[model samples]
Target: MEEEKMEAEDPNHNNWERRPESPPELPAPPEPAAPCRRRCDSSGGRALLGISGSTSKFLMNVITVDDYRSTYWPKLESAIDQLLTQSPGDYIPISYEQIYSCVYKCVCQQHSEQMYSDLMRKIACHLERVSQDLQVSSPAHYIEKFNLALGQYMGALQSIVPLFIYMNKFYIETKLNRDLKDDLIQLFTDHVADKHIYSLMPLLIEAQSTPFQVTPSTMASIVKGLHTLRPEWVQLAPTLFSKFIPNILPPAMESELQDYAAQDIKLQQELMQNGFARGDQSRKRAGDELAYNGASSCGSSQGYR
Candidate 1:
């Protein structure tokens, strides 16, 4: 009775008969906070990640002009040289994909203009070297050497175009409003073709006059190359022949025709047998047809047909 009275008086006192206390109720789980929306910078740049503009700029390792020239241009230039110099059977020092990535990075780093200019300068330098070499070649071998160099340059360009496709799209086509391949071809015209046109003209005339002096395929390539370099010439009246030939060969045409006429049927047969003719026609007939076509075309063109 005394203990019960004491427990009642002191509420803090424990009693064995009392029920165990229940665990305190946990605070209701907090409602999930709404997701924070990312905000893009005013300049249309990437979304900010709590970083100040200056800090973001500082963090980016933007390549400078000098940095690109020193770090990347040399490697790209070396790859181009390898492509231009290597023969079909030779080993390539750099892979096409590596060169392409280099160009792509340059363009991405805001060096598109510099990269474009550098490539143009490099190609111009190469054409200048080719021009110098051609200038020293003997007349007997001039066309052959020119054709070989042209083929090499063209082949190298085919490889280069794909490698620089990004730069071509971003810088060349967009900013300069020019086609890379066309510009390169123009460089060839300015650096090589124009410089040697006078000397080459006589060779072309001689080849035409003397049937076997240059193979027909070689002649065709020369003609096609000239036409390709000066597409505007195609707009001229005599679309049948390379316009440069007509523009330059007017004085020699009559003489060339006379010489062709004087050649025997045996010469014509030889020409036809040598794949000069277009199809399975008789050699004599094809040769006569070729002669007639040549004469008519030459007659129609004031300068070139």
Candidate 2:
């Protein structure tokens, strides 16, 4: 009964909770299909029963990913180089399948760290060249050129982002990490956008306040583009819509004073009247209690005398 009560108290309890299962009865060993069988041959002997390459590798304990790393690393770097050197508006044909395969192999080989580091370095170096190519001496044209180069680079890197994320499903995402697109955005901002694009916010707002060389549409695009680079820092909506709050704090007594200010003379008079009447009623009640106590004291003293 106690056990039944305990089980009844447990809302999730069920009659068929899991327990150790008894071992199932095994079938008798099958008869050998082959005429002859070999046990562990070392002299390049034929496999006992239709052994494939992977099966042979498993048997011999020769399975390794060193060859995969060696084979794919150079190809990966070469594709990145092509991405860097390709001409403007000329789309270099990239074999996405091969790149994804390389990344997948690297992940399989437990070489994702090396691959990620190499990718960061290569992409950073290439982006440095892009930043240099788009450098402008004029502060006025700085935002324009940086933005243009940023767009071009992003367009170029569009094809490569998918391949970089091929390994994200298995390893990178589980660690609570950023993805390839986010990394690329960081690289671009660090190398290119941070210098010219992000620094223009106050200046751009100033210009928006007044007339400027860059048109309103271009300025809008600049703000939008900056948002794409760093979302937290870019809030052009308030600036664009002329929405602003003065930094000056309200007076300390503003809340109490505002209530008084909100009331007209007639309303204030009515409030004072109600408060005075309540106070008088309380005082009158106290006076009546005191008089009754004095009378009771006098009557008791006379009766005692």
Best by TM-score: 1
> Which run of 10 residues does model 2 get worst, by summed lDDT?
20-29
Q: Give the alpha-carbon lDDT of every model.
A: 0.64, 0.53
The Cα error of candidate 2 at residue 248, in Å, is 21
| TM-score of decoy 2 | 0.50
Local error of candidate 1 at residue 211 (angstroms):
1.3
**Per-model TM-score on C-alpha atoms:** 0.62, 0.50
Error of 2 at 38 (Å): 31
lDDT of 1 by residue, 1-305 (tens): 43343234334433223221211222211111111112111212334355566754444334568767776798789877877776544455454444554565556556777888888999899889999999999989999998888777777776777677767876777767899988988899999988987787677777876667887788777777767777554443233344334454344455455544444445657778877774655656777888876775455444442
Clashing pairs in 2: none
Local lDDT at 250 for model 1: 40
* Candidate 2, residue 68: lDDT: 41
